[model samples]
Target: MSEVPTTRPARGRPRDPGIDARVLPAAVAELAEKGVSGFSTRAVAARAGVDRRGVHARWATSEDLVVDALATLTANLRPPLTGTLRGDLDDLVPDVARALSGQRRRVLQRCLDEVGDAPAITERFRRDHVDRCTAVLEDAFHRAAGRGELVAATTPARATEVLMGSLLLRALTVGDDAVRGDALDGVVDHVVALVSTSAPGARS
Candidate 1:
């Protein structure tokens, strides 16, 4: 009689739990230097010092890979809330500003430059980045409104755009180093003032 062969195949080595910690940042670095058009798994593999299989095994599409990479950069933009809207904004707003500089700024610039040609990337940006920001702001703003810290009319969309855009503007216009920590104080103060002085008639 012939011996029966085992039906189940041998399992491969267990995946490195820290592969994301390595690949995502490398993907962002590739995007910063090459933009979307030039972005490639091979380049990222070389930069990350891992086989292309490691990256591809994790992310099936470039869009998927890039969005996850961008997520890592944007992940820390949110700060812990202090209940009071002003205190929350004090930390949250500055955190957003600080993140908009340096290599992260380059990543954003590359995304903006090439995203128009890539609808998949555009949708990913909205789903992963824009929508996340809006959701967080909506929670913060509505909570503040419930407590009478912000006007009931406060619109998270316009406010999110304004606050986030202002911080991003500095990095785009004057480079990352130009975004001063002190200047962010003014942004928070002005927004708080808008709620106070114009709360009744505020559009957002």
Candidate 2:
């Protein structure tokens, strides 16, 4: 008679759900403080008060970790709906300006530098950021159309690119100072006017 194979308990302890909470924030802090150069599993683990294995258990590489951390940082940056698209965009301008400035600016620059080496990470970042912004703009446009505040010809993708592109350009060129005071308001007003005019039956 064949002997029955013995079953053994799984190796290693069960994964802690709390590990992610600790790891991600630590990763963000690391990126914020050290940028991409200092972003490593070992460093993040130390910051999070866990073993390096804990970070590896969650992310395959530093690029993966960075993407997730950046995603978390920008997760709440979506524009709020204030009934009208203009109002929604106006409300979001200050936050957008803030994001493009300060520590976030350094974080973004580091990510951009790393993108050449990590195409996958770049794609993930674009999806998390650009795609999300496009979706938010699309929803805003839809709402505006329903309210007869926008034209059927308006395209969210184009509009999102315009808005994001302008912010990025300003951030890169004139730095944070250009995005403050009346400058930030001016950008918002310009974007709103352009979007409004792009609607049907509106003056160019």
Candidate 3:
């Protein structure tokens, strides 16, 4: 009998990289229907056609799972980068306003309205959505700067907050009404004008 060569089996199940990617869209879709308060792991699992064990296997906690899902959804959205800062911002602002008016926006608003004392969810929103997008927008602003479309003195972080805050405030101001595209355009135009005008030798 010939001696059989044996290979040791790899330890544990190989990690599924696509698991989170697969699970997240279903989660976001569910979250869009149900606010953070009403979000359910079982429902998300059902929607994804996966068992709860699959979700639990990937995320240690529901907060972590939700954050990851929200982040993934945000990532899939492509923020436009036009050559001019105003044009680029004009492309981005409408999306921001729509998010403010859409199902996700209502879910988010519901959670914020009812859950001020819920530290876990609140902190997760702050860290996951707000901070992450702020960083992304800041990087976008830096890219504009590299292209010489932004003022040399422009602070990316502050600029991001200003642009985002305007949309947020406008959404709040209008309550449930759909924010008009013109309104978003106006906000983008205003911010871009402010930044561009501050640059040395900029056209009047």
> Candidate 1 vs candidate 2: which has greater TM-score?
1
RMSD of 1: 3.5
Top candidate, metric TM-score:
1
Quick one: ranking by lDDT, best first? 2, 1, 3
lDDT of 1 by residue, 1-204 (tens): 998887967586656778888888889999899888888988898888887887788899888888888887673556457877777777676557666778888888888888777778879777878678657755666667767665555455565666666667777888865565667677666676666324455553
Q: Per-residue lDDT of 2-47 in model 3, one digit per residue for the tens? A: 9776977777666567777668888888777776777888888888
Worst 10 residues of 2 by lDDT: 195-204
lDDT of 2 by residue, 1-204 (tens): 998869877789767789889998888888877767666778889889998886787788888888888877563556587987888877766776777887777788777777776678779888877577557766776676677665445566666677778888898788898788888888877776776755445653
Winner on TM-score between 2 and 3 is 2
Models sorted by TM-score, best on top: 1, 2, 3
Error of 3 at 146 (Å): 7.2
Q: Give all TM-scores, in the order shown.
A: 0.83, 0.75, 0.66
Task: List the candidate 2 regions with Cα displacement exceeding 4 Å.
Answer: 1-18, 32-38, 75-79, 145-154, 197-204
Error (Å) of candidate 1 at residue 58 is 1.2
Can you list the residue pairs that collide in candidate 1? none
C-alpha lDDT (0 to 100) for residue 147 of candidate 1: 75
